[model samples]
Target: MATTAISADTSARPAAWPRALLLIGRVALGLVFVVAAYTKLHFNGAWHFSDYYFFFGMAINSYNMVPFWAVELMGRVLPWFEVALGLALISGIALRWVGIVASVLLLAFIGGMARAYVLGLEIVCGCFGNSEKLGPLTLARDGSLLVLALAVTVGAFLIKKRAERVRAVLAARQETVSS
Candidate 1:
């Protein structure tokens, strides 16, 4: 009878491809958010913040799903929030929580778009800016973003677990050797 030995090396570690994929997804999602924020904030050949706000608020109001007060507040705040979230994601900081937040935001956007589509309200999406109309394309894009955010979140947790397991195994081996 032949006995085979299993090597307890880093070869037993988690695969790198999954981490790479996670990084790619994170970066892609981050870029999308940053671009969306930029579009909302940008003014053509001018830097009029109030104009941007008014237009964005109008876009939000066009959905008719929220109160005027809420529209004003969201117009003022949402773009900045998106910028922060996007930068966090790109920097890979606090990825697990960031991913969750990103996913939630995308879900909310999708829900709003869906509602607008169902109600037959031809409104600007207020997503990328006043240019994007609420339609199947907008919904599909948001849905894709939600999927990417979710995958990144799940991958982050899985990677964390794998690292913990690896650490435990290494500690156990060290103790055995000392004994």
Candidate 2:
């Protein structure tokens, strides 16, 4: 009988640079979301929280897409939601699902902005705040965000899959050695 040795090599593992880039992308996207939420919630030197929500609601209403009730609900919920999502992204927690959620949110935002622009509805974007106008710039910015989100999402999944494969290979090698 002949005995063969199985060598453990990490050369087939994913590169470190790609992981670094993914981290950078994730943190950057997270910061953007956090800042956006802050802008929406900030009082701009005012002391009234309701005042901020009122203006935010107006911005949502300008789209003329949803009813007043939905506008009220979204206006009140979205900033906090952004804050939570941003924190999750920054913490690198459940990144795959978070990335998906972020991408979907960005898509919805872009769609709304495109609709408002195409219809020539002059309205505040209500993105960062009630100040930004819905125009080419807003659409472009959101579109870029969507792209970033998608890239991060794809990268995350790829890394996860690679890790799984590496683990499987290692496990099989161990089993062979033991046998």
* Candidate that scores best on TM-score: 2
lDDT of residue 88 for candidate 2: 90
Per-residue lDDT of candidate 2, residues 159-178 (tens digit)? 89888887876786777778
| Cα lDDT computed for each candidate against the true fold | 0.85, 0.86
| Per-residue C-alpha lDDT of model 1 across residues 13-124, encoded as one tens digit per residue | 7888999999999999999999998888885656556767788889888888899899999988988899999999999999999999999988888888898899999888
Residue pairs in steric clash, candidate 1? Answer: none
Q: What is the lDDT of residue 169 in candidate 2?
A: 69
Which 10 consecutive residues of model 2 have the lowest summed lDDT? 1-10
TM-score of 1: 0.91
Candidate 1, residue 39: Cα displacement in angstroms equals: 0.3
**Residue pair clashes in candidate 2:** none
The candidate 1 region of ten consecutive residues with least summed lDDT is 1-10
**Collision count for each candidate, in order:** 0, 0
